[model samples]
Target chain A: MLEARNLSVRYGSLTILDNVSFAVGDKQWVMIVGPNGAGKSTVVNAVSRGAPYTGQILLDGKDIRKYKSTELARKIGVLAQDTPVGYSFSVEEVVGLGRYAYSGGMLSSKSSGDAEFVERALELTGLKELRRQSILTLSGGEKQRTFLAQVLAQDPELLILDEPTNHLDLVFQKQTFALIKNWIEETGRSVISVVHDLSLAKAYGTHALLMHRGRLVASGEIPDVLTRENLTSVYDMDVHDWMRKMLSQWEDGQSGNLPV
Target chain B: MKKREGFSLVTYLLFTLAVLVTLIFCVCAGSVSVPVKETVSLIWRAILGAELPQSTAKAIILNVRLPRVICVGFVGASLSICGAAMQGLLRNPLADGTTLGVSSGASIGAILAIAFGVSIPGIEGGGTVVMAIVFAFLALMIILSLAYKLDYTLSTNTIILIGVIFTMFAGSIISLLVTFAGDHVKSIMFWTMGSLSGSSYGNAVTIAAAFAVCAAVLLSCARELNAFAISEDNARNIGVNVRRVKLIVLIAVSALIGVSVSIGGTIGFVGLVIPHMTRMITGPNHKKLLPASIFAGAVFLMLADLVSRVILSPLELPIGVVTSFIGSITFVYIFYSSRKGRG
Candidate 1:
């Protein structure tokens, strides 16, 4: 479980996140939804202990800042919105980097179990076939999968994902959420994800948090917080009509052909 | 898996062998060429504590060639390691000591010593190296502080621009010192342009000791460097202390460049070209690339030193000049080829 209290982040005079608070329960998938620049990514970064925040973030009843980096890493795996890699590491090598903290930052220090974890992650993410390929040569979708596999290889108690499905195809997008859902069921672990796909969030999330203009507008059960009213006000648009229209079109068997 | 293992093993052996062969050849083929067999026997005898058969050859090997060869090897290794670390730290393949103005700043320090006759006690090879190291560290601190003040957004363009400006600033100061030196300008210029022929045992030992310490620190953090090659934010998420890693890398790399320039002057291409070439073979994993670049750089620079001394016989070419010529050609070729691949 994770809890963020009165968290605020600022860059010079600009306040990116102000007094935001949220809690994720055991095995819960908390999907954070917001318009552009609503500080969705900032919240994830704050939890990762990368960005300095004014307030406290507690993981399993302990302040996240109190934990050593390697300790935090063993418990939390993060897939940030933009993971920019410059090198041409092989897919296997990239995935193996997930074991860095555990392996004491040396490949020679890795145990047999770490290799198994990497292989398992590669297989789960459908990247086993491309394990030997250069990561620089991967397509957008393949690269995303590779990074996701890396996160999986960390084998953490919690997963923090910001836009985890951005570059994924429809099939892998579904597969990714399914994999996370399976992880929750199997290990009772939690996931905090910032996603733009409202439909997927509504379908898969156990809880939802709506943010608007650096403020948390709503937070509760997914169906409760993702109501038409909260959706309309947070986005500053009429979403009820759009939802009804889309639902009716889907019911009429005409939505499947819609282009991505 | 087995094939990959074999490939890396072969690469390791090839570079190790190349460095060894090049070292022997460099020691043998200077202005006073020694026969290969004779050179080997002399080295063997020296190692065994036996008196060398020929006194003149012994003097050449022990006094002149051996020290120069050792200095060149360590300097080459240090420069390439600095290059690899800088590239990873900045996440820009083009980053090197020369581009970052560390070398120019060092040259200014050395040239100032030549101009004003400043010397530090206990430092071997005169005050040139001592001053060079001081100025190199100053330049690094300035660049680091500038980047930090700008909120640490060290974009590739920003870093390159800053490096270029710093280089020009250092260059002007060097020019001022050179103008003031008058008759000593030739010596100052030669030092700046890089020449290993002037190296003595004291200079070699100084560089070798500093290089060993710096290389150990850098190689120990190779995994951290690999993480840094990606974005700093990602490295942090993966449990790396980005700020700490950056600081360590900066210090280690600066020390490497300072010691190297102290011994070999601002040898241009060993740092810039060797890492790029080594990465092509090692696939950018710093664990392998770091050591590979060190050996490859040692071999390449020793060979260049050999060519500089041997070609034109008695007249020595500035080692930097030869490296720059080879480096520029190779750089252009790499650039165009990579661009063509992209297109």
Candidate 2:
């Protein structure tokens, strides 16, 4: 279990995240959704030690801050929306780098049995053919998968995704999410994702943490946390009615005429 | 683009063969320009017995050319390794001693030592080497820190601009020292121009040992260097101690550059050109790139040194001038190809 107890983050005198508390249970795919300033990414950054925060982040009842960065890396893997290509490393080479922590200390350029993980990651992400291709030459979706393959090679129990499919086109977006869903379901691993699309969150999340202006507005089962009142209150708009109206356009029962 | 995954054994063999050929060719074709057959037999005879019917050709080959060639070879390898590591670490192709200000910064100690050697007294011999290494690393840290402080990303423009500024600042200090030295100014100015002349086996062995240790440290960091290519945050996420790896790489690369500069005096373009060309062949994998740079750099500088010695016949051109001429052409080609690739 990963629990955040009264976690808060501040930059200078301005508060970014305020006393937010939540827990991710086994096999849970929790989605954090809110407006632009919701501190959703901050929550992920705080756990990753990218940002300093107050209170405690407990991974299996131990304070996360106490864990070394590499030790912590073995527990949490990140797949961000856009990963820049710095050079022309081939897909496999980039994926293999995820095995860095597993290397046999310093001065011994050896790793014990990591090829299996890399191979499996490559196969799972459907990048076996592109393994030899330079990452810089790959298309955006392909590049994202290469990074996903890298994270898969890392083999963390808890996957953290920040707008993982936000920039992808329709087919790639579905492909990416389906892959994530399969990885979570097949491996029984959990995920903490910060997503902008409510429909995606509603379709895939097992639990939901709703936030607004840096505070936890609500949290619990997806259906409960995403109720019309909770969403409307936090968003300051009629989110449910608006979503259904948008959904009506694609529904099977929709009339083939303008709404006039 | 279709690229081979790892550098094949064929490439390594070709490079090794090329180094051997170049070494012999360089040794033979100098001011005297001996034939390949004669150069080989002379080397063979020298190895067989220390004492021979000593001739001027033998003396020039054994006492002069051989040591200088070996020293220049190691110096080339050291500079190239440093370049490759820095380029990988910074994730920028144009990053090296000149752009990063390390070459000029590290020159401070060497310039001081030459301008005021007897005054410092006790630690002239050993202290010069240490001071160069220290300044090289310090310049790197200060430049990186200032760039990062200015902009979180350490953008290319910021780094290059800071490097140029740092070079000017170091140049001013060097100028002030030159003004005060009066008589020593000529010697200090010549050394700053950079050359591989006056090399002895003593200097060659010292450079060879430093190259071995420093290259080993950098080679060990091949994986970390690969990680750093992605980005610092990503490297950390993948379990690399980014800070530690950065420190280790900087220190090792700095030492490599420092040792080369102290002995060879800031030969440019070897570091910039060799590693980049190696990367194109090795596909940016540091595991292959670093080793390949060793061969490529050794051969490149050896060739440059040959040109410096022979291009003007009896009156030698500065090795730095030869490298700069070649480096400019290579750099332009690299820039054009890279931009074209991106486009």
Candidate 3:
């Protein structure tokens, strides 16, 4: 289980996240949905210990601050929004880097177990064919999957993804979310994702946290929290009728794409 | 795939043969052409323990040509390896040993040693070696400490900036010392121009030892260096203590550069051009790149020294000048080709 207590983050004098509190229990799929500049990334960064915050974050009932960087990496895998490209490492080599925290040091040899895990990760992410290909040659969607493979290789207790579907096509987006869902079901691991697609969040997430201007407007079970009233209030859009229509379609295993 | 690999191997073999032929041609073409027969016989006698008459041929081959050849090889290898390592560490293709101020720092120490008339204890002709190591290590420490104090991230630009500042300081000191040592100006000038004429057996041994140690240390850290080439943050995340690795590499490379410069004077371009050339043939994987740089550097310098001697006959120009000229031309060619390829 992971929990953030009274989390607040400020950049200079500007408060980015104001006293937000949330928690995710084991095997839960929690989705954070907000409009642009809604501090969703900040909350994810704060939980991953990438950004400083005023409140405490606890993982498995222990303060995350007590853990070292590698220790934290071992427990929680974070895939940031922007994956910078510079290195010339092969796809396999980059994926293998996910086991870095467990590798001890540069000169230390990888264990047989670690290698197996890496192979499995490549297999799961469907990167086996592109293992030896240079990462620079990969397409955008393939690159995202490569990073996803790396996160899978980490095998963290909690996976934190910030816009994992960005830069992905519809097929890739569906494949990626389905893969995440399957992973959670198989491993019984928890996940907290910052998403922009309301339909995706409503489709796969078990819990939802809605935010606006860095303030948590609503949080509960997905069906309870994702109401037409809540969506219209936070987004300042006339999405009440559209959401009700989508909700009914969603109940019938259909995703009604609302016009923006 | 097998055919492709075989073709690459064959190409490498042809390249090696060509370099060997060039090396022999270089050795045989110097002023006062010792006949090819005499040169071969002299080398055979030395190797086979045959008693040859004490001729100038023996002296020329053993003392002058051999030392110069060995010095050229050692200095070239040292500079290229340092260049490759620095480029990888800083993740900048343009970072070379000189850009890091190592050559200038060593030059300052060499000049100071000459100016102060300091001699090594017990070991004759060890002054340059000791001074080179000392000044190189000192300058490296200063740069590293300054970077650390400023909480500056290790980047190519930051390192280059520090190197530029140190180069200015070292050059000023060198100028001041040269101004004061009017009588020794010729010696200082010779040292500055960088010649292989005064290389001795002791200097050769010292330089060879330094190169071997540095190469071994760097080879063992090849994987770490590759990891660093990606990104420091990534390197750290991958279980490498990035700061410590950078420090160790800096100290080791500076020492090699220092010792090489002390023995052969401030030779340039070998470090910058050799590694770049090596990378062009081989990919950026440091495992293969490091060894290729070493061999290519040695071959490049040997040919450069030979040309410097044979090009002007008895009025030998500085090997350093020849190397710089050759290096600049090759660099221009590479720059042009890379730009054209990109376009």
CA RMSD, predictions in order: 3.6, 4.6, 5.7
Candidate 2 regions exceeding 4 Å error are: A109-113, A244-260, B1-14, B45-49, B118-124, B340-343
* Candidate 3 lDDT over residue span B138-228, tens digit each: 8877875776566555554577678779878887888899999878788888766688888887888988999999898887677677767
- In candidate 2, residue A230 scores what lDDT? 90
Candidate 3 - chain A - TM: 0.91
Whole-structure CA lDDT of model 2: 0.83
**Ten-residue stretch with the least lDDT total in model 1 chain B:** B1-10
C-alpha positional error of residue B126 in candidate 2 after TM-score superposition, expressed in Å:
1.9
Give the count of colliding residue pairs in each prediction.
Answer: 0, 0, 0
Candidate 2 residues B77-190, lDDT tens each? 899989899888888787888778898877887778666672335533555677778888888989999999998777666887898899889889888888988887876676
Return the DockQ of model 2. Answer: 0.51
Give per-residue CA lDDT, model 2, range A136-208, as digits (tens): 8888888888888899999998999988778787556666666777788788999999988787777678999
Pairs of colliding residues, candidate 3: none
Interface RMSD of each: 2.5, 4.4, 4.6
Rank candidates, lDDT, best first.
2, 1, 3
